[model samples]
Target: MTIELYTWGTPNGKKASIMLEECGLDYSVHPIDITKDEQFGAEFLAVAPNNKIPGIRDTDTGLTLMESGAILLYLADKAGKLMPTDGEERWRATEWLMWQMGGFGPMLGQAHHFHRFNKGKADYAEERFLKETQRLYGVLDKRLEGREAIAGSYSVADVATWPWAARFEWHGVDLDQFPNVKRWYLAIAERPAVQRGYSVPSAQDIPMP
Candidate 1:
């Protein structure tokens, strides 16, 4: 059986699709066009109460799930691939993944909204988001100072946060300060799986920028 992923091109949505691709899971992508408010429609709302993208229905198990983090964890558990088997390593990866879900995703999402999508340039909004975005980048940078991936492995935790790091410039957050993140970002972004995963929701281009 195959998994069906309803997703958009946003960071959170990309996280799940990237994981599915990296795991070599057979799946289909149903692009939920946020611009057209497809997520708010009845069909999507049935799959996800929050009417959000990045949801899945597992035909093999008859389990339907929402929220990117939950979906990532579920997929990881199902595949037993990206997550660590050891208690300590698994906990470490989970903690960082939660950090990305709670801290990084929200802050950077707001930064993108205020900095790029909002009407007019709001200095206060920019300052607020940039400060938090920079702080979050610093946190990740320190965590990755000498590491190759988050939790010392290229797991779901790393995939979950990769898109945000790649899109830092859009949030007015500089990459030079987070050299370690930059290194990891370059490595992951260049991966064949990541390339394919990141391309699913893109109807035209695969975000070369």
Candidate 2:
């Protein structure tokens, strides 16, 4: 069951690689260099119509998938791990995963664009995204209080969120301000699979907050 993981070093891309490592699945990496606009090439588009960095083709099932969140769910189902089988726990895990897909990742991306990469070019965009980023962090911190993982027990929720939180510095986030999130982020950082996955297709140190 070798999965061909099409990805880069971004957070969303890391999610697929990290889950692959966690599932102990045999896989190969195909680096889609978004930096050089290779994702837009027709060949890559055949796998991921959205032209996204992280996509996958499961050789055993002949399934090609796009979108990091969808890929996570599919891999969990295929491996029968990370995701809960039933009950409130399952829904709770799904909720947090959705939260990451909707708010955490997208907002932080905008914050990174405005606050970090293009600072002063659009002050209003910067301020709006940065403020939203802080609010989202506060929400996550509160959810993490007295909890080890985002959805109780390490699951897809944690896998989805941790990579985004790993980029705290890029979005002007001070993990110190969100102690619970900081603790959660650090705890996940220590996982051997996470350490391996964070450097998928290339080697890069996980940024310490």
- What's model 2's TM-score? 0.98
Mind giving the per-residue lDDT tens digits that candidate 2 earns over 1-209? 57999999999999999999999999999899998999999878989999987999999988899999999999999999999999999999999999999999999999988888899999999999999999999999999999999899999999999999999888778899999999999999999999999999899899898
Per-candidate local distance difference test? 0.85, 0.94
TM-score for candidate 1, please give it. 0.94
lDDT: worst 10-residue window of model 1:
200-209
Per-model TM-score, in order, reads 0.94, 0.98
Candidate 2 clashes between residue pairs 3 or more apart in a chain or in different chains = none
Question: In candidate 2, how many Å is residue 153 off?
Answer: 0.8
lDDT of 1 by residue, 1-209 (tens): 47989999888888888899888899988889999999998878877889877889999987899999899888988988899987888999999999998999998888888888883579898888878988998899899988999898888889889977768668765576678877888888788888888877783233333
